[model samples]
Target: MNALGALAAFAAASSLFCGATAARHSYAEGDKVKLWANVVGPFSNPSVTYQYYERLPFCQPLDGLVHKPATLGELVDGNRLVLTPYDIAFQQNRERVTLCSKALTRREVQQFQAAIRDDFYFQMVLDDSLPMWGFVGKLEKVAPATPAEKETHRISLFTHMHFDIAYNLDRVIEVNVSTDSSRTVDISEDVTPNTEDGTIRAEFTYSVVWSPTDIPYAQRMEKYRRVQFLPQHLEIHWFSIINSCVTVLLLTGFLATILLRVLRNDFLRFSRDEDAMEDAEESGWKYCHGDVFRFPPNHNLFCALIGTGTQLFFLGIFIFLLSCVGAFAPYSRGSMYTALIVLYALTAGIAGYTAGSYYRQMGGTAWVRNTLLTCVVFCGPFFIAFCINNTIAIAYGSTAAFPFGTICIIAVIWALVTLPLTILGCIIGKNTRTDFKAPCRTTKYPREVPDLPWYRSALPQMLGAGFLPFSAIYIELYYIFASVWGHKIYTIYPILFIVFIILLIVTAFICVAMTYFQLAAEDHRWWWRSFFCGGSTGLFVYAYSIYFYFQRSDMSGLMQSCFFFGYVACVCLGFFIMLGTVGWRASLLFVRHIYKAIKCE
Candidate 1:
C-alpha cells in the first residue's frame, strides 16, 4: 500500500479498536480494597428527599451533619442499612462518570476516604472490600400530634434502604413503624460517588444508624421535656416582663400626678396656700397622693431602650413562628435560617430607630454609641460565629455555598434598607418629641454620683433578678442548643415559643423588682441599671452552656472550641437585648416618677 493510505487505514483501525474496548475502572473486583460509608442523618429520607439533596448545592453541606439510621421494616428487611439497591456506591468527579458500582477496590478506598474525611468528624467506621455480599434494614417513626390529629397521639413512620454487590449495591431494605421495633434507628443515606473526578455521577442504596427508639408522642415529649423548653412558657415570661415594666410605668405615672398636683400645690405651686405647707405633715403624705415613689434613673434613656426591645420582641416572635410553621424543615434546606437572618435585620432597624430617637431626645452626646451598639447587638456575635465555623470548613474542605458574596449582600440589605428606616425613625422621633415631652428634667448638675454600688450594696440581688427568667427556660434552651450544635435531630421551634413566654414574664418581673430596689437604694442611674438587671439572664444561660461543655466528654477538642465561641456569641447577644429592654422600661418609669415628685413637693 502507499504510505499515506497505509497510515489512514491504521488510524481508522486503531480508532475502531479503542471504541470497542471496555472502559477502565480502578474499583473493579479483586483490583483493590473497598471504602465504607453511611448517610449523614439519623434517618434516611424517602427517595425524593435523596433526590432533593442530590440536586441542591447549599444542602450538600448539611449531609455531613447526620448519620444513617434504621427503619421499622427490620422484621422484613433484616439487619441492613442498604436494601434493594443497584450500584449503591456513587462517585462525583471532574471527569468520567460511572452510573453504577457494586464492588470495591483500592481506588474506591482512596475516594471514599477523601469524601468521609471531608464531611465527617469521626474516622471511617469500616474499610474493607465487599465480600460480594448484601444486607437488609428496617425503620419506623410516628409524627407528633395532638388527640384531634391522631387518636393515639403518635405519628407512624416506616423506611428501609439496603444494598448488596455482585458488581454494585444490591439488597432488599424496608422500614415500618407498625412492626415490633422498639429499637429503631432514625438516620442514614447513600451517596453518588465521583470516582472518576472528571464530572461523572452516580448514587446507590443509602444507609443510616440511629438510637432505635420508637415510642408514643407523650413518651417522646417526656424525653424532650427533659431537654426542651416550651416557648409558650417563654411567652409567659415575656408577658411577665412586660407586665413588670407596665406596673413600674403605672407607679411612675401615679406618682407623677400626685407630686405635680398635690405636693407642688402644698409647697412650690405658683398659687399655693402658705398655711398648707405647714399643715402637710409627713404622716399625712399618702403613698397615692404624695410623690413618695421618686427615684428613677435615666428616664429618657431607659424609655428609649425599652421601645427598641419591644420592637425586637415582636420581631423574634414572628421569626420563631415562621420557623415552627416549617420554614426551616430539613427537607427545605437552610430556608429557615435565611428567613431568620432577614428577620433579624428587620428587627434591628426598628431597634435602631427607636433607640436613636430616644437617645437623641435624652440629649445623648454619644450618637455613635447608639448606632454602633445597636449594630453590634444585631450582627457582631453572629459574624464571629460565622468566621469561626468558616475557618473550620476551610480546613475540612467544605464551604457554605453562599460564601462571602452572599454575606456582603446581607450586609447591604441591613445597611440600605434597615439603616435608612432607622435613621428615618430617629428623625421622626426627634421632630415629634415636643408633642409628647419626656418628664425627666436635666438637672444643672448630674445627681450625686455614688461609688460603684455593683458589689458592696446590691450586686447579688441585681444578678439574681437578671437571671430569674433564664432559669425558667433552661430546659427548653438545652434542647434548642443541642438541636443547633449537638447534631441531634429535634423540633425546637415550639420550645422556642415557650422560651419567649418565660422571658416576657421574667423580664417584666425582674425589671420591676430591680427598679424598686435601685430606687429604694437611691441609685438613679436607671439606664444602665435596668440593662444590668435584664441582660443578666443571657449571662446565666451562657453559664449553663459552660456547665454542659465541661461535662460533655464525647465532643472532640475541635468541636468543643468551636462550640464555646458559638455559645458565647449567642449569650452575649441575649445579654445585650435584655439590657436594652430593661433600660428602656426603667427610663420611662423614672421620668414619670420625677414628675410626681416635683408636683407633690
Candidate 2:
C-alpha cells in the first residue's frame, strides 16, 4: 500500500477515536443529592421582602430549612425580626428537602452550575405535571475564585430560586424534585465545562444562608413603588422632583398672569375701543397682522419637523400604554428597543401625512421633494447615529451591537414598509382639501422687527422657554438614563406617561408666553423663535446626558462613551422635534386668535 493511503487510514481512525471520546464525555451518572428550601434575605435596614430559595443544592436540607412559615411573633422580637447575621450559621427551624430529580449525574450538576454562573441567576418553577426552572437576577457574586478563573466563568449562583411573595407558608406552593436514581445528565449543548484533568466529579455543595433585617414592610414596599428599584441617590431624585414642580409652578404663574391680565386687557381695549386698536397697530405686533401667517423660509424643513414630531408623539403614547399594561414584563430582553423600532416604522404614515399637509398649506409646489425630505430629515440623522454606535460596539466586540442580519432586517422594514406607507400618506394629505386660512391678508413687504433688549431677544426667550420644560422632566430623565446604562428596570410606565403630558403642557404654555412677548415687542420674526423655544429643551437634556455619563454612571471605555453619546444625541434630537412642534402649534394658535380679534378691515 502507498504511504498516502496509510496516512489517510490513520487520520480516519484518529477522527473516530476523538468522536467516541466526546460521546462518552457528554453523559455521566452520580449519586442522589437533596434540593433544600429556605428564606434567606431581607438583608438591609430598609429591606422587607425576604428571598425564598426553593432549592439549595449544596447544604444538607436538615441544616437550615424551615418546614413551616415563621409566625409574626416568631419573626419579630420587640422591634426587629429575629436576625440571622451572615457571620453566624443558621441552626434553628431546619428540615430535609425533596428533589425534583431524586439524583442527577455529575455532568448534569455541572451543567446546571454553569448555566447559573453564566446567566447570573436562575429559578425553579412548579408544575403539577412537570416542574421547571424560571426567573433570574443579575447581582454581584458571593464567592471567591482561583486566580486563574475569569470573572465571567465563576459560578456565582448555586441553585438560587424565585417564588411568589406569600404571607403564609401554605400559600407558597412547593414541588418535590424527582427522585430518579438512574437518571443521567448530558452536557448541555450551550454550556461547555472545563474538565480536562478527569476531575469533573460532583464535589461542590450548596447552602441556604439567611441575613435578616429590621426594615418594615411599608418602607421597603415604598422603594419598590418607584420606577427604579436601585438608584444612585434616591434623595436627589426627591429634590429633583421638587425642583421640577417649583419650576412648573413658576411658569404656570407667569402664564396665568399673562392670560388673566395682559392678554385680557389687550382683548378688551382692542374690541371695545377703536382708537386704542388703531394706536396699538402703529408700532407693535398689531401692525404685522396681515403677515403673521405668511409661510416662513425653509417651509419644507418646518413641515418635516412637524410631521416627524407628530409621529414621535403618538409613538411615545403607544409605548407607554403597552408598557403600563405589562406587555413587556414576561419578555423584557431587548423588548423596549424592539418596540421602539417597530412602532416608529408603523407610524411613518403620520409623519408623511402631516408634513405633506403642512407643505401644501404653505403653497409648496415641490410636493415630492417636500414629502421625501420629511422622511429623510429626522430618520437620516438617526440612522447615521445608529451606524456610528453600532460600529463602535462591533469594534469593541460587544454583544450589544446589532448583527448584520438584524441591521438588514431593520433596513428592510424601513425601506419596504415605512417608506411606502409614508408616500401613500403624503399623497392623501396633499389631495385633502384642508384650509390654510389666514385671518388677515399678507402684504408684499415683510414687517419690520423692532430692536429689543438682550433678555427679550430670540436666544434668551428660547433658553427661558426651554428651561421650564426641561425642569419639568429632569427627574424622569435620571431614571431613564439609569435604565439604559445601569441595567435597572423602569417599570413605572404610568408615572412616566404623566410626566410626559406635563412636559408637553409646560412646553406649550411657555412657548405661548414667549411668542406673546416677542409679538408684543413688535417682532414679527417669531416663526423660527417659536419652534426653537421649546426645542432648546433638547440642549438641556443633552447637557444632562453628559453630566450623567460622567457623574452617575461608572461606565468607561471610548466605545461605551461613543455608544452612549450617539444614542443620547438621537434622543435629544427627537425631543427637540417634539417640543418644537408643541411650541409652533401654540404660537400658531395664539397668533391666529390675536390677529383675528383685532379689526383687520
> Estimated TM-score per prediction?
0.54, 0.65
Candidates in order have lDDT scores of 0.44, 0.60
Candidate achieving the largest TM-score: 2
Model 2 TM-score relative to the real fold: 0.65
In candidate 1, position 546 carries an lDDT of 73
For model 1, the local distance difference test gives 0.44
Tens digits of per-residue lDDT, candidate 1, 404-444, equal 54557777977886666666665565555543353443443
Candidate 2: residue 10 lDDT (0-100): 35
**Model 1 bad stretches (over 4 Å):** 1-311, 323-331, 365-373, 400-402, 435-442, 449-459, 489-495, 590-600
Candidate with top lDDT is 2
What would the per-residue lDDT of candidate 2 be over residues 329-441, giving only the tens digit for each residue? 42123345555676788889999899988888988888878878888888899889878877765664443456565667778988997899899888888889486998999
Candidate 2 RMSD to the real structure: 17.5
